[model samples]
Target: MNPVKTIQRLWLLFLLQIPFALMAQHPVRLAVAGITHGHSDWIYNRKLRGDIEIAGIYETNADRVQEFRKRYQLPENLFYTNLEQLLDKVKPEGVMAFGPVNEHIAVVRACAPRKINVMVEKPLATTYKDAQEIADLAKRYGIKVLTDFETSWYASNQYVRNSYKEGRLGQLRKVMINDGHEGPWAMNRHFVSWLTDPVKNGGGALMDFGCYGANLMTWLMEGQRPLSVTAVTHQNRPDRYPKVEDEATIILQYPEAQCVIQASWSWSFSRKDMEVYGTKGYAIAADPVKIRTRMQGASSEVSQTLEPRSAPFNDPFAVFANVIRGTLKLEPDDVYELPVNVTVVEILDAARTSAKSGKTIYLKPRPALVQAGNVGNN
Candidate 1:
């Protein structure tokens, strides 16, 4: 072979290998703040994509840590019992909170100051106050704080949202979201403990599953605060979940539209679905990929199987890595954005108040704390 041709082929090969080399050498460093959350195993169970690296994990429970070590065959040096020590040592780009809902505040407080982003499961916090504080910390530190919801990545939901945004659904008149499972008891015992505790997980079904509706509605409304909130809660399973209500129905009245959220832990089957009605048409998201819709001219509802969302939007960890690496920008009312999740906590707060007082609770305004946080610009 000619030496010049050989040298040129080698140079081309080296150029093609550069991207793969960078992916292997500099995967996004991610830390786990807690391990008790049932969904915490997502990070370990996911097939390696070479885009994320588990830098460190901080869990107070040694047994849980051991269980994770044995299950995933992770090294002992990757675990830390103390949060601050882990943060200081690994200095990961982001931290995912897998503890109780109430613990989100502490995770944000620690990660924000360190200039590390955070992603927590579902509701941003147990209360509006904690949510506001997390938003404030994110704003102050210029870090991204995201809430992960399994429904957010649903292709059906995304299809509906896109159609609505494109004026195909017309003005949204009513939206109904149903989300829940049989109960937390059937899941991990540790998850059930905090999930049932009123203080740790907020109200039972209302906060656990209700947040899904609130989060989705807030996103559909473009982060607008509702006019008033009314809710009714019941302890259908008093024998099992005595400390908190097992079922809840929350109504949100807007100036031009309304929403009904049915959240229950007593469902015979697990489900996460939504029905959206507009002035000119309607769309029902029956599952992650199936949707039924009827437009004005359509004779009847039509069903469709939607394609899954593309990368960075399909996975929560992918989103965190993209945001931290400055490859993806979030919208003001993105389902996972801090502002939208903050409003979700606010709605839950009002729902709790309404349920207890048996009166409709009129929202005064978006709290000044939330407004001042500059969460939308993120």
Candidate 2:
């Protein structure tokens, strides 16, 4: 071939190889701590993306491992019965817990000493004690511990949050958050077993879906602990959820705002929507991507559809990847931050207590509670 033709051929080859090179570059190496949680499907079911790669998975149940492997066609070598061994083998950059809520502490305990960050599904822990321990461990090890919520990735929620922060919503007044569906009893046995267990899941809808509202409210309050928590719970389906309540309603009172959280497994249909009312206007996150709003003096409410969020905000794994790679920095009370989730766990804990006692529970002042892992760093 002529020299000019040879050079042209080389340039064409380089262009052809660019996409392959980019596809294989800088994918976040992540480990799954457990695969029993119902939400564990999030990892396996997500559309393939170049930004995240599952390095290893640890599940104590051999049957579950086999089932998942067959279902997802995952490699045999990628499965491990021991978490620590899985971590040592793959050396993942972070661990995402797909275990029972109480088991989050174990995941963090193992990863923290290794200086590996962790992200757990919502509520952080089954109890406040575990949440505090996880927080302390992360602080001591200088690793990031995040709690992931599906709502955190919602464009509508982000839009509402931005509107509030930018003063479009004006001073906060009340927020109403509705969450949950018609129970998890119909889910797989592995998921249903732990999810309805009092110890494994903390509580029923109060701990399962209640955390969403608590997490959002804490973030909206900028990590402020609620002044008081009042709650009522009902066990509507004794045949299905024999051990836990199927319905919960919680009231969070702030100095100048109040939030009503309706979390139920008895809803006629699934929903995860919230309404934020301020002095000047109100915004309703109708769903993940739709927002209904009414501004001060506006005659009619307006509904707007939002585009998908940009990278690092569009999905939980994206956020985790960006944070681990130092491309994203979490604000003090960003919905996913540890402190906000800690407060969320606190609120859930209080809600459980109030429901049990049929009395409102008063909380300590913000400063006093901060010492005990109540707030995130500003």
Candidate 3:
């Protein structure tokens, strides 16, 4: 080849690489809706890291809008009075709905038709019908809908899931989990407003904190949908949480194992721990971020803890950004499929039904498990 021709071909190859490199570095633009939820702060801080831009913020309540603006030092132009105006102006690639549970459906409905990816705070919607509607809308539009079950993305949970896949826990038989904090009334004065309002919050502490237990249990058990769920609720602090139950104990039964999930807004003590018992070994963890395990024949327990590497928040905004950038695929949909946001809503609804009926409520039969070898095909 001629010397000049050889240099020209090399230049062409370098130019081709530039487009791919630039595309890899592009940021995802995200607009956040409803700044009243506590988790919104995490999203705000994480999005500031340069991978994502907080294009806009919307809140229905004027007071909340003012509070957020002052807290975050957001400019007036970036604040909108409602979701429709915000979406129209910003045209974000994704939206984080951090609104109240009752407002979730409306926000999702508004965004899904635009084919915007959305990450709704857990317990997708306040009611079963609304939850199903959101899921249906997203499916129709081919929008990726996810819940902010942040713990599911924790490194410790990933380690535990990997262990379960390796059969280290061996034929799981039972799980015991607790997720509680001081009652909402004591934790925040505003918590009692909509959270205790059955019309707005849907159920009670079960819908709020109980969903975490249900989601975590489902994730750890290889996505085994519960066959039946039975629950009991208590209103011990009726004066404080006037319209909502203060505590709840739930049992989720599967073909292979039974899970006990306890949630409360009345506990004076704070506890967040999980114990997994199986035919061969047992695993325990304070949160999904830390876990220890023991196998039947092992001489001693093996322990692992994931050091917090990022900010104090549990926001997975970077993960979402990577998904958009095509740098990382969504978590495998096998034993530990990334949860579809609506499924969390459905599980919470079932638990509430079981509690209300004073009897076990059976779920629709789950599809056959995607066996280990065939998991990736989906």
Best-matching candidate per lDDT = 1
lDDT of 1 by residue, 1-378 (tens): 999999999999999999987864688999999989999999988767888989999998887888889999999999998899999999998999999999999999998889899999989999988988898888888888899999999989988888899999999999999998898877877778888999999889999999999999988888888999999999998999989999999999999999999999999999999999998899999999999999989999899898888887788898888878877887767898987899899999999999999999999865456552366235
TM-score of candidate 2 to 2 decimals: 0.90
In candidate 2 the C-alpha lDDT for residue 139 amounts to 74
Winner by TM-score: 1
- Evaluate all candidate structures by whole-model CA lDDT and list the values in order: 0.90, 0.88, 0.73
Question: Candidates 1 and 3: which is better by lDDT?
Answer: 1
User: Where does model 3 exceed 4 Å of error?
Assistant: 186-192, 299-302, 307-314, 332-340, 366-378
C-alpha displacement of 186 in model 2, angstroms? 1.0
Q: Per-residue lDDT tens digits of candidate 3, residues 1-378?
A: 899999999999999999988876677899988776767778656435567888998876777777778887888888887788889889998898877788888887888878777777777787767866765676567666566665655666566556677898888798887878887664433445677888778878898888877777777765557888899998987788777787999898888899899988877787777788888898887665777889899999888787753532244677666554556555544212333344456677887888888988888864333222222212
| Model 3 TM-score (2 dp) | 0.89
TM-score per candidate, chains pooled: 0.93, 0.90, 0.89
Q: How do the candidates rank by TM-score, highest first? A: 1, 2, 3
lDDT of 2 by residue, 93-120 (tens): 9999988999999999999989898999
Q: Give Cα distance to truth, residue 97, candidate 1, Å.
A: 0.4
> How do all the candidates rank in terms of lDDT, highest first?
1, 2, 3
Clashing pairs in 3: 183-265
